[model samples]
Target: MDSTRILIGASSAPRDGWLHLDHGATSEVDRRPSTDPSTESVPTGRTQRVEAKGELDRADAASVRVALAEWRRWMAPGGELRFDLPDAGAALAALLDPASSPSACDGAETALRARADGALWTAARIERELESAGFDGSRVRVDGGRLVARAFVATSTSPSNSGMATDPTSSAPDGAARDESNTAPSAASHTAPTVDAPTRVLVWCGGGERERLRDLLATYGRVLTNRSDLELLCVFDGRATTAAAFTEAAGAAFAATLGTAHGLRLGCVALPEDAAGLEALRAAAAIRIAIHDEPLQLACLDLAGHVDPARLARAIGGGITEPANGALDDELVRAASDLHPWFYPVELAGHRVVPGLGSPCTPQYLESRTAHRRQMLVDAVLERVDMRGRRLLDLACNCAYWTSAWARAGASELFGLEGRPEHVAQARLHWSSNDFLPEGAWRFEQGDIANAADWKTIRDHGPFDVTLCAGILYHVRNYEEILRWAVQQTREVLVVDTRVQDGDEVLIDEPGDLRFNAIESTRRKVVPNRARLIAVLEELGLSCEVLDVPFGTALGVDHDDDYAAGRRITIVARKVRSALPSARLGTSSTDLR
Candidate 1:
């Protein structure tokens, strides 16, 4: 990180709110009364020194020290009294002119003694900034009066899902200082944010211009907000900025779309973009998905009409107010869905096929045949599977990521079967390119429910113990015949995973009361079909465990990385009697419902 310093010397009494910045994010100022102790204090003795704390590099801190000292001496009725805060750069140019605000008073001894004790407020600010930068001063000696810090900045060159510096200190007022070295005279009281050179800069811009503003805001707020990662909504303008910002956008969109769009305002911050925004966003870093290249694009949209409950729901639940610029078509948009909700709390090392959950058990989808449904399907399968485990299968696999993982895991066997030969080819290309296919473990074959007879690729493997069949259920036109056929092929476990919707809310308490609503033909879009899927493996005498859970799919809402509001389930059935009439499993398409 480069550092530079700028010093400003002022020789006048500090102006009231003089430190409040007016640089236009073109937004209103944060006039909301601060809850800080300084805000409540009554000014008493004229303080000698001044201090600013936030995530800033070395040059920035030095620059501030020089500026503050010069300002203090210039304002000095007898000595410099006012101080200037530095920007993110020039923190290292701390050489304040000694003549200005020189510690020459007899009272210097007392001030020095008092400073040695450290004021709570100022120390807290410095401490917070240091911690956020991944530096804990607990190990550093405080008497030396230096706040040490460490931090990491993100670097990604992806086209859609791009990122910038993550370190907070690079933009803070100064490098961490024990702060007492520059604390105001102990007897003096402070006021609201010092009305001098602004200690914090809030950069705001609308639409695409948000990217630049975001970096500026990120630099300052990281420490000012006492967070390593600031959740964008922290407003330097307080409420007026966001309120007026959203109000304008809302009125504009509503007036333009009127009632035709059904829902004009799309999405709300759910949480305010205040200090609270910083808190809420910090936890979701793992899955903190950015929909647009610019994080600010969602800023207004998130805070829009959030106060209005009915409006809020309509915006989020309705269709995409504006189609995502398919730029994210590849990145962020995993598999294909906007928000993949595949991660769930299922034991992977030893997961059981729960009864009545629908089709396949614990095994999950790795990649999508289509980028559109990729995230949603990956999210669903991940929800069903545990986080651990190096070995996996991509049965009926489209992308073959499961086989790739097993090969990567150096598994004994990683089998991938796709109904389409082209898909198998694509899967092979991917696994091979990634160097994930092991010498003997990974295998890909072209096999479909209509015709596995000629699908010789899988024949060499023989009757395998475990297999994954996902998305094939609803696509299987011959639902019954396919079920029996799939059963005969499996020796130990047949994972019959598929989509099932509760067509009626009249819950059937008895498992035997289950009935197939309808069967999907060979050529049909299964996503929107208003029918429930039922596994017909019972005739094969397999002990069928039906899981009625519906994971999010192409037909459903974007799945959160955490499984929520999905309708996909997995079924693990054991083949008890392969003796079920083999003639019954022939090519003749049979409808189960």
Candidate 2:
């Protein structure tokens, strides 16, 4: 493929798909062409990294291992080798400093750094440069494009249990009554998802100011501390004496000071004329950073082999849901119990425990009740998503669980309009933190789940692409009226997950104070009739496909989940096509009715 430009922060790194790379592997190497200051030099010691893209072929693995081993010897103390080998080329040579000429593509015998840590420093220095230019650090590699080699630095955060990480930031507490056997499980580290590429960040900051940067790093660190593969490194540039130098020294100081304090290897590039000057100090720093902890990147890749990507994607989604709010009331009691606040792993940690869901769950009687509710959520989700790209509206989106999945599936927009103050607040917190999307694009409004008095205010701000109505169908007294109201608000697709049941079941919330009177009859319990939902859609002159999804205690079933023989039924319906397909993603919302 034509070389792709990888964006790393503000910088860029050029990349070519070489024969040796696989997903998730990482490497560090010295790319400087010659150690001879008399010959040529442009920058500091450079390194070439040949990390596996994911898993690699046995041949490529052997070749990389052989090359790195040989490189280690050449880079060792008092070990001096010349750039004469024709096969490996000047890729290694160029990493030391910019090379005299691009090494012949056939591979040339280039001088090698004997120390793996030295290679790490060289790789990290190169990463800083690449990032400063705006390249995705993950894309840095060797044998990219016409070049002999490029270098990179990398790490992973796998929990070590057979690659299953033990989280330091444990799961959100269910508020199970605390007993001797249970203490809040330690939180899990913010590990790269099993199926996803490992995350790497180079914090460039000042040396003494590390205390200032600690909080920023801590936020990410707390989440991933339990991960086995994550490596945090600071890269520092030189410092300035006067505050005025901040304008010039800010970037450098940020790199140098913080990097130095955090024990990050320092890097400064010196010109050949000053080969042994401050420039070498800079180069040496960069080289040291590149080679430090080089093996971890490789370890992460090996661990990557154990995870199934598709499974991880789903699991990560589960990780972001927030805990449900307050004490369970009548209406909520009717809902399943297993309703964990979405994004529980991140949100309800350290403080703010969920009642009855954690270590000391109470009135175990209610636990079984909520267990059914949890199934309702999962079943409802499976149904709503069947219609990808169909616009959706999640009314009363508590933590926007469906909205997220819909968004991922390419739903135009699952406008999560919330009326409940508690749900709205919970949703906002998750969104702002990137625990969910930054703005919760799927979320646009919050107010009475049963009312729309402020809808005009919402429009003044903006409109949604699709609408999702979750956690609201049972609360409203005027179900049909609200259904029409919600449809009128949607532009194209609309998916609503609500309470329903077979004829006259009169499903009462387990707490049994509130009521879902005259419930619409569907195929089964706590679900409204498909025809009733379609009636509203047809009256509005739209076609809808009603698909049933698993729910209730089905969520409680672990592993095969075979125990959830049957319980709740979730129906997903959406507009088939718009009379106007040409409408922009924004302008279409008003057409929902």
Candidate 3:
């Protein structure tokens, strides 16, 4: 009764002030008091706000009815209950929509199959169920392919719910009448949404390193290609040389690599390497790149010099220290000294870990990208294959970000195999730092997926329910062998997220560098087009479909252009009991092009 807010199924990232509870023992909340159903019922009549996201659809009709009754009983007068469920009605409509793309229909079908466990609830049916559970006012509507509902407990001044019936066409709650054509209830009114700020890169050039400057510019050029929103500012020491000298060298490098400095919003300014210069640099960017004779130093700086341990933990894996008198913490600076720049932002300790600057894959951008990918996977594969009590294999799971995500989604057992030992160590560090997963529930092993001997180590883990091959397919030349191994090890579903070409298979050869998180060269890899990738999966006895990217002006996060341009894709392939129909080129039912 002390807490006024309750968030069910908060997964890994539970809010600070809210009372969090999830279904299984994997979450930290499950260890707390009153979490066990056999011990005690949830405290009633005190919570002012309650939210159950993606939880109601996991239970049957009776269980959902009971849960609604319990929620109603637990709410104080005027308390609000908001929840979202997979919208079966929306999926069915999309399936019937002639204008819906083939990928959309495939996604719709996948969603429908996922909710076939008698947990499907349309908007009207959910509103009626809420009214039956003694809610005075309730509103249900579709948002982001889910049935978002809001119900309120009646207060003394509010109308009684005794004989009220919910209108199927109405947007208002019971005992209230509102125009249906008007705007629907604001779903995000209660929560403060995270704003995705633009990514700014501060390039600190110490001078006298032409090759280093060229290399840095080349790296940024590759990372920031097709990304126009990111800003790159090169700050040079005024004492070292004239601003013009630094600008000239940098301009030549930028021109050679990036084609032009103007396209990248690249600029150069002279500043002394003192407190004033640091302040100026701080005002300009969040991520800083220090170019020196030694290896490049990448660190995220807090402009205010505010020392937050959690943020430090997220930025660097560990090394928390207290800064004195609002000064920049020396320990934090030292920790970031050895850190390699991250191409993909990894979520650690509830915040995203973005080690480098101006990659277009900032913490916010990657967070949005991850959410979009997760939603697509849910609609395509996860909705049908429940993660609960299932085993997951993450092949080439760099730092185990997706592995941890599956654990949060209720996968009982997780095994992550990566090519780099450093990444394996990082995966272990992530698991140790986070308390969402129980001990012995997950394991991280270091191995190359391209090695046949490594497959022996992976096979020892046995057949897995779900196999994840994200960010690995386009990096290997022997992709067929990898796919066969994944299919042989997977029992139900295999989710693959990779970069694909448009036409014939293309081979790209790039340097194999640990800094880029590429253990192998692109020369040893083949970037298969979308059609070829699907055909291979279908040949392996799995039905495959390319998941649609949700790209629109309404989305706040800046997604990478590769996704929008169909150069990158996420395909979910499910194992079939019988052989899949031989899908000829351009003739497959799942051809999304």
Clashes of each: 68, 147, 1
lDDT of 3 at 14: 68
CA RMSD, predictions in order: 25.2, 24.1, 28.2
Candidate 1 residue-pair clash tally: 68
TM per prediction? 0.33, 0.32, 0.42
Residue-wise lDDT of candidate 3 within 1-593, one digit each (tens)?
23477777745356666666666312333522233232234566887988888776557667788778877877998799998776654554454444668897666555444221234354435655786887765655445567677888755332211111112111111221111211211211112212332344545555624543444454333333334444455655566666567766665554433332124555555543455545544444443323221212334433232223223222222211122222444443333323333434453443334333222112223333455555555555665567888898989887676667667778888888988776777677667657647879888898888766678777888689999898777777767667877887889988988777766765544332223334643235677677878877888789886777766311112222256667668887889964344433223322211
The reply for model 2, stretches above 4 Å from the true place, is: 1-392, 410-415, 435-444, 452-454, 457-463, 504-531, 548-567, 577-593
Task: Give residue 29's error in model 3 in angstroms.
Answer: 67
Which prediction has the highest TM-score against the true structure?
A: 3
Q: Please say which candidate is ahead in lDDT: 1 or 3.
A: 3
- lDDT score, residue 2, model 3? 38
Error of 1 at 237 (Å): 10
The sequence of per-residue lDDT tens digits that candidate 2 reaches over residues 162-218 is 011111112212321211211111112112234333333223334324322332232
Q: What does the lDDT come to for candidate 2?
A: 0.32
